[model samples]
Target: MSFTIYLRCFNGIVLREALRFVHQKERFFSALVRPLVWLGIFAAGFRSVLGVSIIPPYETYIPYEVYIAPGLIAMIQLFNGMQSSLSMVYDREMGSMKTMLVSPIPRWFLLISKLLAGVFVSILQVYAFLVIASLWDIIPPISGYITILPALIISGLMLGSLGMFLSSAIKQLENFAGVMNFVIFPMFFASSALYPLWKIEETSEWLYYVCFYNPFTYAVESIRFSLYSQINIEYSIGIVIFTFIFLFLSILGYDPGRGNLQKKGGK
Candidate 1:
């Protein structure tokens, strides 16, 4: 195919998925509400009580709200990414994913198009939370605002691909709840989302190492550093590596000969 034709087809896939999100206004509102509640109510209640240590790049005892805004943004992406992947699982059960797979486009492109759509939706949720955060004077640097866009996109793709990987493995929606309990919370808390690595280290060196190993840790820290206008090389590299790994795993998970989806009676 010519370059322009390929690009147009790619754009069309992205647009169709995006429009599906637009049509589901309730899901969008629900995504927005979860982060807002965490940032506005839960964070506000804990802001004064939480004693944040002076970590590098953060020179002072920043408010809990300020410290966690990036994490909350990450959470939105995480949730949205999983939700999108879950939707794909739903599509498979309903035979929609099979239809999508049969399309002339390469499987990777089709899968990535869906991932990009999820990232786009997650970006919108992140920005909406930022606007609400601004109302309470919990804003990060104005410059950090623009950079957060790409950061959010990268985070979104990583988490979304993780979701895709999980969906590819699980046979039914019935099993997802267990993953939500065991996987989601641990990944979020073990990361730098709610606290710094220094604090986790003070508690236990091993715990710090565990957090360091979490891909979400780098994603959160990447956003935190960008918020302060400092580039975090570790976080950037982590994002790239995690994105590729998850995407590759998801592709394998979706492969036809593997019986990944076929076992579920989805051909």
Candidate 2:
């Protein structure tokens, strides 16, 4: 009811999510493995063929590994977001979600708390990846590391909100895997994550358009620019806009009075 109560609610939610992440060692490792594999193996293989031209974020020609590093970071946040949604669906089936939803705190606050909790976990994963990448010589400027935090936060929220909205459409935990694959793969591959938008354009115009419109592309670009201590205002604004849009949809979907919660027979 008061400010302190709201603070405690947020702290409790964040702490719970952090503890869950700490206990799930496999979750941490799995999150790193996918991006690491691409960084170590795939990036190495393509280093010669995929030489990157000077982009706004980079003042000079850079290696393929360097160019894709931000994309991999975005990938970590993207997967972390979906993982959060999977937990939401799990909680729903276990009936724990209903208890939280019925609490005195506002529903939107509760959902945003959960979203922030997931973002906290995601920032951890992204930093861990950065540490490993640095060891492998993919380091950015020291200042770049500091400047990138805000970008990561915005990107994480947008992706996590998307996952929350997707969870509302999924009635069962089992169906999530299929849906995740359908969404994740296309979002990753179609975006400018692995290749530059220009390269995609050279290959196919329609695919280039897909990359142009994908929010994930903006997420990656925002990170890429931020890591170099530059702000891609256009991409950053796009990410913020999508974050709000997805957050609104997630709040709508989780509303017991009018959202998917009602369809699920939630009280």
Candidate 3:
């Protein structure tokens, strides 16, 4: 009975998110544009200069655009997460969050449903980006597409949970746009998303450690490995750990008894 209720709640939340996505047509293209622009501009500039090592799983030398494609895929998920988090902030301000909190479901279940909804929306945007990349001749192995599905879901949920936790932590903020700017860009750029960890390490030891420690790096590397039909064991484990940590933080922050949500002037 509890499982049934949870399933129904999950379905309803995903449906609502899907409907919202259908209405926001601009968001679809906007998600696509951001990465493509980065890919186009960076690939054009760095194609000749950056030498990609013969990394395991990636059999041969690949073009710069192809190398960054997984990162861009992860990028779309990261931005989608921030947007979803912003929506949560808006919901709280509008009093809708109160209604959600008052529901019969467990708060953790609600959080999971919310995370899944965001993941679903983000995955749709990801495939659209992939389709465009393929059209641009940045194709992957056809099997890679099949294998990437699970990777996308795991990566999407990790990023979405991080955003959700961030929203809950800053529940008092009248404007959460700053979180979007401050959180998203740093996580994206500081990771293995754009450049190899080795390359970044060569430039700065501290920065390499930053990238290594960044959960986003694991998320991106996990996706990159999946794209080539290989599993990055260490990074994959890192993503799971980070996801659970963020999930626990999210649950705590939204708990009014323990968290800032119901406290006046709390951060």
Best TM-score among the predictions, by candidate number = 2
lDDT of 3 by residue, 176-241 (tens): 767867888898889988789999989999999999999888889988989878898898888899
lDDT of 2: 0.92
Candidate order by lDDT, decreasing, is: 2, 3, 1
What is the per-residue lDDT of model 1 for residues 1-267, given as tens digits with 9 covering 90 to 100?
A: 577766877788789878888899999889888878888798888877778978866887788888888888888888888888888888888889888899877888888888887898788888888888897777777888887777777888899999999989988977778778877889999999988788788999999999999988878988788777788787898899999999999999988888487787773
Measured by lDDT, the strongest candidate is 2
Please provide, for model 2 over 1-41, each residue's C-alpha lDDT reduced to its tens digit, 9 standing for 90 to 100.
Answer: 89999999999999999999999999999999999999999
Query: Which should have the higher TM-score, number 1 or number 3?
Result: 3
Instruction: Evaluate all candidate structures by whole-model CA lDDT and list the values in order.
Output: 0.84, 0.92, 0.86
The candidate with the higher TM-score, 1 or 2, is 2
Clashes of each: 0, 0, 0
